[model samples]
Target chain A: MRITIKDIAKRTGVSHSTVSRALGGNTLISEATTDCIRKVAQEMGYQPSAAARSLKTNQTKVIGVIVNSIDDPFFSEILFGIEDAAQQAGYSLFIAASQYDLIREQNIVQTMMEQRTDGVIICSSSFSADKGRQLLANGFPVVVVNYKANENFNYSIYHDDVDGSQQLTRHLLALGHKKIAYLGNSKSGRTSLDRLNGFKKEMRKAGVKINPAYIFEVEGSEPELGKDGLHYFMNLPDRPTAIMCFNDMLAIGFLHACQQACIRVPEDLSVTGFDNITLSAYTSPPLSTLDQPKYSIGNEAAQLLLELLGNKIENSNNTHKEKVLKGSLLVRNSTSAPLQNE
Target chain B: MRITIKDIAKRTGVSHSTVSRALGGNTLISEATTDCIRKVAQEMGYQPSAAARSLKTNQTKVIGVIVNSIDDPFFSEILFGIEDAAQQAGYSLFIAASQYDLIREQNIVQTMMEQRTDGVIICSSSFSADKGRQLLANGFPVVVVNYKANENFNYSIYHDDVDGSQQLTRHLLALGHKKIAYLGNSKSGRTSLDRLNGFKKEMRKAGVKINPAYIFEVEGSEPELGKDGLHYFMNLPDRPTAIMCFNDMLAIGFLHACQQACIRVPEDLSVTGFDNITLSAYTSPPLSTLDQPKYSIGNEAAQLLLELLGNKIENSNNTHKEKVLKGSLLVRNSTSAPLQNE
Candidate 1:
């Protein structure tokens, strides 16, 4: 027969409540009592039941992590961060992939709630402020990653995309490139809009007018879109001298297309990318990209959710704060001065 | 006030147990009664508590998946399959990563047991037959993935690694490669041993003498190990013209080393990898590899566990069995006839 906490309490001549407190390592319990109970529990080989304890405390110590897709390397790094932080806090994680489907996101959220997960950290593409608010209203702590909906919704962690994009554009401008093309995700998302706005702002700051024909948008996160974007720009009557892509995946596709066309990187054209995934370093010519604090963002989000579960923060209204992480530009072999002929 | 089953029963003029059966869509209940109860429950805006129902039935409709590490793309692909299949079966998954630590694996198993998880699917690297026997003794339905302990414990889902490696070696031999080297993982795992046996068997069948100096063992899964393996082999007086890696990651590392050394793939040497990951296709020269059905293996494991949970399978000792999935060789840009000279 399996040993139970009750048996340990009985053996230690302590009340079950006191035994529970001691086993949980509550500071309110006397040190001597804690040691005694712990010793007895160990001797008896008693294992605390997570389900029974959760029923009494209303906290499962389980964090639900929902990602847009698991196949993407960017999100995988973020998940690693979240898992690392969660493990440090004596918590386990339950992961689900939304697969970029809004309905699936909703379903996953509902399932997490049904599981009575103490909190959730979401790296979703289509999650809305309204949904976050609904969860908050239902007493669920949620931390949104990589996207912010509204300032009113609490617990959001994102990179400063606008600033990051602005810096990237300025670097290109400083390199003496005047005709620069932007390849990015569709404007449906706030992230894409922010990046676009930042690129335009940087261009205006440099006293250069934004060229309408130099901007292209892709509908999804795939390298093929990047290839298509490159093909579209290259066919223009006056093609830009350089291209800035939304992410490294797109940049890689662009590079592959250039390779196929016998166009050398940093020679015939210079290209830059965002999100310095590990693969960025291995690509031919090595991609010059933005290094977003992907892992730290995930870690901080998990930390915030842990705080909420611990009741370190009171009330949902006060938790409606945004944490924006900074990004950096990693210059590798991919970018250089534009050709003098171009 | 939140509506409960009692309220629904009262409104429907039926006993609470009958109402529960009807609302649960239990086959024991009449179809007309189920319809009536469901209508009344809907009218009352009654939501069934999954937790409460689970407590009564002892079935959470949740499967626990424990993986050795989530950082590897191989494990990630397997997880995707498990999650997809579980969702389709109206079951939810709770994932835990052990980070390749044995203690963490044990703790995860204990936690899953405490949660009353219907069944478990473990894709672990360090589990022993003793642990498997212990779990079986405790009446837990477990499907081991990627590793098998003993025939005493049932329900294993794994690819034919030995056969897969043999096929890979034969492919290299058919390409007129006389000197073939084996690049494999450390001797700590059965997977590595199986692959080594396959490679040796194929070489012996081809009447080729095995050179001990040509075999290299990587201490870990790090890409740097692959580079080191390549450098070690290249420095030898008699370097093999063809190299067969234990897996795709090692192959990628080897490829990276070749790129750095300015050694052209399939020209200076031919290379092959196992477990054809998505990134394998994007690697320079692409990778010729064995396509393991990682996702399908996970799906089958989950399905087996679910069947065990539903009592659909016989629990008799003799009824337990292992399922082996076949793998195929994916010929890509990485391999060709070896050059006339090194």
Candidate 2:
């Protein structure tokens, strides 16, 4: 089980001392000699002990995941999906949170590089595609989710936010709502913007004007923001009869706010949310939202990274495997026909 | 620099072959000879190369975290805490879900051993203290969280579930409620039993009678189970006026059932929950829960493991370090005095 320097020396016809220096990456040794010695060591199936595994394969077979926060059930659902795929691929996952900080994201990425991670799957609005491109340029494969990466640096996955929102908007419009409102995240990111575009497209097609007075966009990841947003919409003497929210977190908050205000849902005001996170269906009146399969999104991201790590996607005509999975509209009790008075 | 066996051999005044055999733990070598060679090897600052680094150091500085399910936001919140401490300690965390299965936990523990992890922090109900003791016997440090291990083993941390539950129950009792119901997880693990005992103790102190008809204990981790449990309660001719649930997940579910059934929370029947998970506040009526600081529990567990891994907790008068941290009561909107009509 023990491999001696003499073993490599005899195999490569080099002095034992020279083999030792070359294998150690000693600067005094020529690069060609070192590479040759290392390659032979690898070919001879010399398994480094557990502690040395870091140096031997330089392939930890580990995937680094960057998310905004794990406390959000949305990210956890995605992680469950990632775990399924990663477990099947015999890879382990290590996670870090950027908390939407670009510098933190960059630092984590640098650390991942230092640890020689095979690849990373990031769901970040702050992480620039240009940064991803730099990683790709350095022979690292990166997958960005919930946001599209530039085609030049490819491996991106996201929902067709426009389509999902359009479907949701049309659902409300079909029920005879013209003054529909859009409640979005305070810090609007790619998905929020995409969903907004989708909502506008449907509203335009139906000839229903966008009510700027009814729009409520606020900062904060808390569902409480949705409750805070309600004050703006309700204060409008001619408040929109229906509201569409950026995600379920805000929608749940909106519902709580209405409950506090003693306004009945659908009867007094109709509301809809996107990204049917787990707690959505359990909410009172059950939430009407778009079902973005977070699990599938995670699974797909892991699958892509595995393919990239296995060199299956490298040098292919499909330079970057970009995916935008479609989400289905889940209509629940939260939406209904506008009241006659409205 | 190359660390040749000859270097150690010269230092020990032994043949190079003998030094190599001794380092290999060759049974044929005398114990004294092997001990001398090892001590010299240690003193000479012999550093092993990547392939050989594995043989020299058993310390990988990695912490293996065994969780039941990362999909649950509760666990994720705990993980956030663990990550906080682990990152400060310069260790990386890799998590695995046993899905509440004991066999899988053991398998993961074995795998972690093969990987040579410095220590393991487990938060699985299915994992046994006996198993933990076995690992401890083997010189592996194991920190059990949210579950108590026999003092015979040492290194355990838990939330004072009984204390937290008693406080919440007392809050409901002080509000002039005599017929309060308890909804526990179907699994009814040790934590559930402790919480149940606490609820009973508080009720007994208030001189309130127990109603067998109102106790709902069923198995499962689903939040939707709250809705299903509500059906049983509402059907009773003499139903309890208030409900204290196992955790935030089930409490959220119960609140949804009330919303759908046209029973306004706190107005019709007060409700309370354990483990004030993040979404507890977002729920309609905002659950009045026992604020279990999940993050702190995770932090403390990681800190304990770090201490154990650093040999800071070894060879002390206190072989066993058992911690049961205190939790506070959070009065949210979910609970109120029972209605006179009901």
Candidate 3:
């Protein structure tokens, strides 16, 4: 049988209320008595019930975190940061993956609500803000990370992809690469568009007219897609001198293809990637990419949620707050000036 | 205010008890009344509190999963599998990372207990079975994966690392590479030892004389460590023709080092790795490694936990059960016979 306050009180020859106060560390109870009662409780293996306490206090001390996919290295690093912050603040995380399914996202939110999570952090970019309306309408604290929804969330944290893309493009342009192409991921929603825009803005500034056939937006952003992009670009009648990838995974794939085909990177064709993941640094010749502070993004999102939890307002003001972090350019061996004849 | 059964009853013009019965799907309530009450509850946004329900049923419908780290690709894949199975059973997961900290693992288990998690799946290999004594003593269902502790757990699921290492060693031997070395991670506890032992066992079976200096066990298993191993081996007076790594990450690092040093793979040296991670397939020259069924291991662990939860036995049997899964060898371009001169 589970040990309760009454059992402890009975063992200590005191009332249940006294045992509760002592265990609660109430100032009214003497330190000596509290210590004695805590010792007895520990000896008896007393386990406090969060459900019972949450019923009275209306605080579960739990945070709900929804991600697109757990296996994605990007989201996993973010989750690591969130877990660190939440654990420090005495909060447990209820982690779920939506797998890009709308109904699954909604059901995850409903389950979190039923479990009485104190707040929620949506790390899934594809999660629509409209699906979170139920939580927002009920005054639950919700924070989003790199949200792609049309509707604005009360709190959000995201990396500045456009600026990062501009930095990469600027690096390539400075290396005298006029024949540069952009490889995008169709599944990345607004992120792909923002990155492409940044590339265009820099190329326009450099007085370079991008060839229509040079721009290729593929279905996915994995290494396989990057490999496919490599094949498509190499097969073109007028191949690009340099290619900017959607992310590091794509860049890695492109590099692998080049290695297999005996085409030297930065010698035959220059390549660059975004989101300087751990593997990016270890790739052969290393990759010149944009570094996103994924951990900090997650940390900031959790900090914002904790702030919202502290100041609960019954009225929904709908005045949203957002924090955008910048990504820095990391120049490495993957990029260089094009051939003199090109 | 949070909507309750009382509000549903008031809105539907029925007694609170009738509303409760209807929401509970009790057959005693008429179908028409139940449907009407449920519809009214839905319209009112009635959120059923898990705390209230769990207090009566003593089941939280929550599973606690403890991992070594969330950012690791291997563990992330396992977590994905666990999430799929648990979600199908209408269970939410409380994920905590011990990060190889013993105290943190204890605290995580304690937090899960306080939260009244129905069962826990310990994925951290470093998590000691002794620390889980409290949960076991209280009859809480516990499952461990790749557990390192000497004490056995009632339920466990792990990969057959020993067999995997032997397969890799045998592959290299079949390529006529007698001068082989083993690079291991010192921090991997039993896993590292098992892989190294397997390498030794295979070398002995092949009637190959072992070089004690060729076996180097480092403190980590990252790509950087592999790079260090490459340098260490290259500087040796009698360099081994082939090196077997503890895992793919190390092999990736070793490959990167070989590229920088202008050493040709499959022509001058051969290398093999265990645990065929996603990046292994894209690495330069690709990687020959062992593929652990990471997802299935997680799925099986969750299934076993669910079964244990269903059968709640009072007496502790202490007759532990273990499930070991085999790993398959994947031959890529990373390995070949030694040079003719050598």
Candidate 4:
């Protein structure tokens, strides 16, 4: 049975044009008329063709989200928050995972643009910043989440990593640990650099000289690196009694390494981490870490993007609009005063 | 400056209709023309309206996913797998969280249908089985993930929960645990029932009487419930020396409760959990669990949906199709032989 706009109009007691407008998803139509038309259309099992419609109104109502990796809990939570808000606003999301490859990220963005997405949200790696800026310059309404690009031309939403790292370090200092080590990813991006600086700043403020040997940079946040960091520090002639890691994944890894080495946590050594993921509390002797408001960050990013797409705010060349949320240190069972030298 | 297809046609010395057809995202156009027109469109900053094009093609190229909860690690990983496969197929995904509310699940499906989504993937609570059947009856292409419904009219992709649970119980039995306690959610769904039945089947096969006192159902899968489950069991006159939980979250809570009570894991009592999430390995003494292929399940579901949407296969109601993935148990530090006294 063929279903048509005329049939829907006849069933709803409306003109074909009105039925067409309602079926076209035009918000300008009366709610009652649109509802009536939609009911009749659903009853008739009518399906509108996407190809012919693109020729008339140039909007797809689909938002594209490009992320570096979806396996990370942090990014996954952000994606969930974005999906929640997008669903509420009656928009569908198309996601592309670039797997931290610069060329892949660029290709995904270009593809989304060609697909005629309404807007884009990018969580890119350092290698893709240039391409990201180009997309923004091309007048694509883009929102950069988590990563802070060296080139500044787009809207960005990120947690205050610098402040969060400083607070974590301060907590360690207050615990009477004079020699503290900073374990983090390779200083390749702004996030790592900012965190390293924050650690140094807090130590310097406390009149403790920064020990060059105490700081370690690694490749990834896997448990092996954490174990290697522990092994490296444990062998040092004058190893610091405490260490602070860049994120929780590293901390958990380090914790496991400590157990393997028969080194007790908060006893033989004190360890701290950032990003208070759900697994933190479940770890044996729970982990002490900093908590980033991941959900809120995603929520705000979507809210801001919706404003831009809805024309609720002026799209001007203003450089002062930035949303920087703060992170908090959550004390758990992992950190304590170093054991007295025995 | 208003850039239009006519301007691009004039610049390229082509007919406007040809340019429109070329830029209309039709695959029938030659690659050369599509490439030339796309290059010209990009150069001209031609933004195609996806909203308008979807009206004529009847193909939004979008899939709607409704899950019971987004925060659960199991569901999140499944979603990631789905997103990966969908993105690879050039399809977009829109996700909705029902929070296990039947009414909200129905509402979300209705909205997705109204938007004329190509298909939907639902991981709903068992209480919504009737509504799910109604959706399938309405000619919506749907694939149920994780949960099975009453009527087998739609596609279903899930793990072999019964086999996995029985394997876990048999493992505990081999470890010299005769008195085993079952800690799980209320038996209001097929998943819980299946898991419970698997345990009972294994126990009966071993010629052990099923102890009604050993099985306790909690209100939810929260930390509080874990603590309550422990208290309820520990208060019994003849408490089991070993316990098996429904999922990792509950296992974590149970472990925390044991910690507070000073119960030595693997020494006084052994505990096991299903769903070996990344956190399970990080827990203190690590949680022994059944590892489900969460990501693979999601990937297969998306792949199946894409195949259906592309009309790559014929629909045969008589053909019975089911993809049941097997799960393996990872023996971590959490499980051991029962204590002599208990």
Candidate 5:
């Protein structure tokens, strides 16, 4: 059996805390007590933990990872990638959820600091500069993934939301969709704005006048948000022929809502979504969405953080500190040529 | 800014390890040297990490969580529950995926031990007692959720697979369906057998003899497994009217396969699944499955671990060390009465 401080405390008749303090070389403890505890600990063959090595070398071989939520399929895929990369690099991840709350983000960061992780990777998009200031001031290494702000972080990996949105919009336009609505996620900050801007830019290029009333932004980006968006559009007197959603989750909710309302997709309305999560393909009629390459994003983010920690592995792409990958448009059963009802 | 051992080492012109050893009270170091390093650490106002507190109090306020796969929706929902419960008790989670590999499971357990987490919760059903010997021999606190094995573990929480299976079978029988098939996962050990036995018990109770050919076992439990099961059932000369799956993922795959073959659910065939995961509800026709109370299982598992750690919260149920909860049958669009043939 592995021996611990409690075992030594039991043998030496001292408190476990005293054994810990004496072993830690805390000067407040008398030399006689320290000597007695050390001798007993040595006799018991107590092995020092990696944490003990951490105290000596100042490296714990652990990385801190913060995500928006654990159950979200999008983040889960990303986490799978992160875990694979970190494991290969001989590092374990300390995972925490921020749940898109500032106080929680700060608290998680603080906890990571107290744990003295070598570096941190933030997969939560809404993580602000203020929440990360503690780590920054200490010259701690951090790599952000798909974060809105680009000024503070020296290393980051993100998907090109604007470009991906334009591709989705262009596909709809090519299919003869003139009245296209953009359903966005207001909580996603810059991601929402970028996708919206991309839709507007693509419309301008096609010489199409935008219907401002057709564009709507909701507080969330889940399937429920998409459901709510469908209700709003159905009530609109001049609802667009096609609706572009923020992500796959919202698109799924919209499709379910359509099914309940007896609206035939592409026959009555067309729908498009960004971030092609795994479930997107299994949805009824499958979903037409953008392939976000979530796993790759996470893998690259961990690699970037590893690089920042000065352990750049051989043959890694280390040239760019900031990387923005584009998403591909997947045309599936959820979208097609809208009914010509001029 | 938090001053670390490196800061003190830099000021004293000594290696960080020497500074660490000197401060930790290692006897190998000279008395004068230890005194000097301690004074420098004090002068620099270096804040001892929570790890230091861990050494003193024998607690790190961290819990290690092991799962079969990080991205599996079933496990993710359970993780969501564990995270919520751990956070409420001033604890953080260190999550790892075992991927159902024994070596990986052992490695993860070793890593968690090395980190000195207060306790561990194993959500991986395949975790063997031999793999946990390190933690066990050291008298480490462990709580398992839905583990197949009952021996060697004092605290465990699991869904009543047999009872849930019977409930699902009874529902199918009530629908006047006598021809039923069971699709199980080979890797799930006792869980698969228990569920299969439950189906058998219910069928026998109704004076129905099950066809050995109607039952099939696959190596996996994913949606892909369900799809493969469907192919096998479809080729059989005497295909059953309804198929009962081991879990929600497989059921989803089966439904998708039916959709591809133009086989209308509940009209040509009926399907049911266990562990009513969130995605199960979003399937094409929705799913008629057993709700396993995944979140509650996880929440209670963490709470049980907390109790084992001797921090039992007020009003917490600490009555049973071995608790098996029953699943409820959810009848949706999947199962129905088989067409009559004379």
Candidate 6:
């Protein structure tokens, strides 16, 4: 009862090869004839089986993307950019979240391999350089995204976290904030670590001895932890004049705590966040943070993936195995000069 | 150097059928044997090809999900819920964005069909009932989420949006706000219309005449539009004392606009949002909004799809054709009695 290309050829009074070519999007067939064949095929319920075609080409034209959490606004925007680029490049995506679990990450990779996806891009999943090398050795085109650069992997794309955090720290210093605190989230792998290093480097350059008591690393990225950090910091003998958070989400949490504790931002304690998410712009006082090229990172990741798969792009320099994008500073209402008393 | 099941069997010193059963995850093969065979297969770089196996059993063991935007925080939470359930059910996901474009939606559906996905769950894409009917008629299982109920399709799951919005409206009314303007984003198909209608219905029940001037339907769901809406309303001759937004994102935008205008929340422009996204809770004043069961909707959708696909579970009611989850109002710091002024 299944309809086939031959049946369509018989119905259209065309050769089987012509029907096949039209269905396969061959430009050799006239547009009018292709349209007619497509209409007939749709009416007849002829689904061009990817499974059968994949057997011949050994390519699914599908890419797999694994992220820390899809719900995190940061990953979502990157995915947005990735999708836009993937659609144009004629590849569908198999997206999953690892939730920062290594076992789940491995299972997802194995599944993508078994499905024989053309390539994969991992964004913030904790798959190591060694494992990435193994996949590459097994002839898989892989790209590690939003992670520290590992020399073992042939392909990767990440942000300049060190520069970004340093810029944020100096921004606070320029505002005359000497007694600044850091609200950190160490759980998100090396990106946070890099951000912390940048913060420390800028502080050291200004001849400020790093205060161990001022650095607070929390468990999660939500505002609740930030709020909790605020309570702990406020109870200290000498509260910080400003706070630099791991990211905007944590900063927003601290801002929320300020509202609860009757402490005004920038006046009582200036705050700066990393990764200027869309929501960060709408937060009360419109968060001052580091503007990560989230969408571009995703877009370039997909572009790099296609180039790795030997897809020729017009006027693109695909010679580079890895692309490093930079994050800029977005000065908004959340940061300002420290109060005289503070 | 491609290895086959025969090669695997020879190495494992097991019959080809036993190797097949073990690889297939059949219970007939003992766990120890299956583990040994899997370890050997992994060592040999053996990939059980989905294409070859799908030819025997025409299922992909994958689900395709198309949403309006993953960057939208609400959709991400729903997806969070879906991934949790899907992972437990042992099905991987192929997620993409339709971006509310009908052609793209159809193309995605066609792509999913060609890939032989076991089922699809759509979150606010522009796939109409007729197209859904056509897909169902062609024997594809589809679940429509946060969409209106259509009799033509036996599968659908939606939030009780009217009830939820009415609750929000009533909450605003109880807080002593009589003149309230709605900052709505109307482009989002049925969900938006249903929300607007719920707002009106509650006002009508309270014996208040609906003012057409106060109902401002914005373009997109972003905060910028909401901010623009706030500017227009603030400049009005007799601005409403309270504002109800289409969702929390709009409410946050309005909150931002208020901060820029020196308009204090609750004390000046009391505001409310819907769909209690996680970011909403962190916004200044902890936005009062309606809580939609985003995760549950996704979990139930997958559960229903599995049920429809005849995948059995312990103590599940597969007879239910549809599930409608309800949203509840969460009273927070965003709303209060209106200031006694014009």
TM-score per candidate: 0.90, 0.82, 0.96, 0.88, 0.84, 0.90
Question: Candidate 1, residues A219-254: lDDT per residue as tens digits?
Answer: 875776767897899889998988988888888878
Interface RMSD computed for candidate 4 is what? 4.2
- Model 5 achieves a DockQ score of 0.40
Which portions of model 3 show Cα errors greater than 4 Å?
none
Tens digit per residue, CA lDDT, model 5, B190-304: 8899999999999999999999998999998867667789999999998899999999888888888898888889888999988887777777778899998888898999888
lDDT tens digits, residue span A1-342, model 4: 235788888888889999998977898899999998898888877755433444456555667787765556667678777877886886666666677666667667666765666678876545476777666665677887777773464577888888998998999888888889988888337777788889999888999997899989888776568888998899989988889987888888899889889999988788888878776776667889989898888888887788778872445546435689998889988888876673
Q: Candidate 2 vs candidate 4: which has greater TM-score?
A: 4
* Clash-forming residue pairs, model 2: A51-B54, A52-B54, A186-A218, A186-A219, B186-B218, B186-B219
Q: Candidate 2 overall Cα lDDT vs. reference? A: 0.79
Evaluate candidate 6 and give its CAPRI docking class based on DockQ: medium
lDDT of each: 0.80, 0.79, 0.86, 0.77, 0.84, 0.82
By DockQ, the best candidate is 3
Worst 10 residues of 3 chain B by lDDT: B311-320
lDDT of 2 by residue, A290-319 (tens): 998889998998998888888744733357
lDDT of 3 by residue, B118-227 (tens): 99898887676676777777667888888756365668888888888999999999999989999988888898889998898998999998898899987877788877
Clash number by candidate, in order? 1, 6, 0, 23, 2, 0
- Residues B1-342, candidate 1: write the lDDT tens digits: 346799988998999999988876799999998999998887775655556667566677888887766667888889888987898888998887777566776777777767777777878755655655656655668889877564656778888988999999999999998799998888338888888899999889999998899888988766667888998999999889999988888887788789889989988889999998877776777789999998899888887877777674565445776789989999998899987764
| True-structure RMSD for candidate 2 | 11.0
Best-matching candidate per TM-score: 3
lDDT of 6 by residue, B41-104 (tens): 8788887888778866878788888788777889888887777778788888888687777777
Residue A217 displacement (Å), model 5: 2.3
- Candidate 4 is scored at a TM of 0.88
Worst 10 residues of 2 chain B by lDDT: B46-55
Q: By DockQ thresholds, what CAPRI class is model 4? A: acceptable
